[model samples]
Target: MIDINFGSLFTVELLHSYYKDQLCPDFNILPSNQTVKTLGGHQIIARQYSNQLITGVNCNGKINPPKPFTAIETGAQFTFFMQLNNPLFFNYTNLSSATPGKIYYFTNRNNNVSNGKTFLSSKIAVYNAANTYAPGDLVSNGTGITYRAIGSSKPGNTFNLTNANHWMVVDKNQYLTEADALKWMPSISAYQFASPQASVNISVLGYDNIATTYTQSVFSKTIAFANPASSFPLDLSFLQSGKYSLTVNGIQQWIYINDELSDSKTFAVIDIFNDASPVSCNLIDGSGALINPAPHYSIYFLNRATIWKYILASKQSGNINDTANLYHFANPASVITSLTPIPLSNKALNLKLTLNNHDYSPIACADPQRLVTITKGTDTYPCSEIFLNF
Candidate 1:
């Protein structure tokens, strides 16, 4: 599907109730090929497709954890949960239009002879033998009739369809719908889309840079494409681009690194920036500050990190210990050309630099704002623009 990429401004404009503009899920546009070309403009990148996975017993019939038969259509950018074995015999509740006793062939969204060939190659394990299936959705040797992903004609999972030993096609994201996609996994990130509903074919290079100190960008959580350090979460929602604050009581205390709430990563743990009792300490900047906690920034009792991310917003009173440690990011733009004398605390952290057009502006130090960018080797990294107070 083609989409317009006016700016984050447009995405913001959409926050209001009702469909002010069409970014994704604007189904009215799916009329024909010409309609696809018209709305699926340059800005509308990627398609959201359904990638299915299964969770049955890994053995001949037992189901397992983390699931099996899991596949990700990187083009759609999500995983699927297709329990590839026979349907389970639900007493009553677990039946649907697409369920047992009803073996139906979902004709290709883009039906064609080649599409026919792809389905033939695909295979689905039927768990519930009691259910009535299609007259001939399956085909097996003399052992028994098995439900085939296809019927007749050119057989096999098409193109890269089902043709695989363990079907997980790398980092593929199908540009599809959220209801279908996020079932792939939430915080995995999902979006509605306009469509040819086909895979997006572009030479995408996902990379990132780690600056000792980073200058801020305007995006509440900027669309930082590069990868980050091992400690940060891969589902970089909080770090993306958005606005959120840390408050104690009602006053503001600190800011987070990115926009959106941070989700749990495999190795992620939240370290407290402030507390009442001082652990071994390192004083930073002019002040070894441990100020009061604003309502928004209070952590009653630091909780252990697991799959869930919970900010310590003080709900009860017992967990109050108002000692905090402060850390400042090194201002990046203030280039110290050749300071024989290091500008210490006597001088505020400041830097002077010449300005030209939009290149040399001070970074907007705001929370959830973007802080990084990725450039190819030939392209210059953007640290030189930071002008700080000396």
Candidate 2:
């Protein structure tokens, strides 16, 4: 007798779908077995048995499809055993931590260059009905409202909102009131540091468009991070809507603050795949705290080396313990874990977790039998015996 593992060729979902649709409905035929060579060069014995086709070469007495079978319900619970060839250690490190970086912002406001900084241009003059207006010329009404000429117009053409052929509104009011300042606060949405620093200086500089060669300091402050694993939200709610240059440490960038529109947040994620057991896993941070809302399992198959590839979904958060992280084959044969929705500034957090061995001690045997049990509703299916080297 030969054991054929369909898992080597197809995903659980694909196999289930094929078994449910393509298999011969007649069950009267006697069982037959034949050796077949796959395109990948692996030879397997295929057998027509019962209503399903079984294919695999027996490695010892283990079952052909070593992985867990498909669950009957979405809430099915899967339990699997795992053994490590070597003693497990706390060697997992966090590589997705946020690092020091800078972001830049720009706007459509008119600017003048002087020295190395850009200043708001003051070349806009009050609208003069007797003067010919050219495209791109800025003009203001007596009430501090600004408009730009979109087309060339003679003295007879008026430059105002009513004159759509010649003018378009730029700034309804160039001067911002206290209420406007309270409403529009610009901010640096996110930034990261390579390492914790004692003190970081942040400066916001403003410039005037009237050929001013000096920098107008708007906001300046120094911040210190008590913990490198934490992120800080820099709020510039006090800043009015305008263009300004922001400097963090020595790095400088331009930013345009629009009312509420400039505020933002950043996020990053890490994915973990458990190839050994179907049980849920935990993600422990550097402080030994289980990451709240731990990594959940979802169907992913891009890394599978088999001929069959299909996507499957786990309960959004996996099982009750939230441990159903997806499984994939890695180069060194290990599970991958993921943590997500992390604040971009807190990328320095160190995270770690252990594979299911109760004791960190090494296993002495090879091809150890690992039992996997999956339960759905009242039905409990014990997976076929799997001989795993690790």
Candidate No. with top lDDT: 2
Question: How much lDDT does each candidate structure score?
Answer: 0.19, 0.32
Compared with the true structure, what per-residue lDDT tens digits does model 1 show for residues 136-225? 122222222222211112323221224321121211111111111111122334332233222221111111112211223322222332
Superposition-based RMSD of candidate 1 using all C-alpha atoms, in angstroms: 32.3
* TM-scores, each model vs. reference: 0.14, 0.21
Number of clashing pairs per prediction, in order: 80, 23
RMSD of each: 32.3, 33.3
lDDT of 2 by residue, 171-244 (tens): 53231111111112345454555665566788988753233321788889988767552345677768744456
The best candidate in terms of TM-score? 2
Model 1 spans with C-alpha error above 4 angstroms: 1-39, 42-116, 120-122, 125-184, 188-390
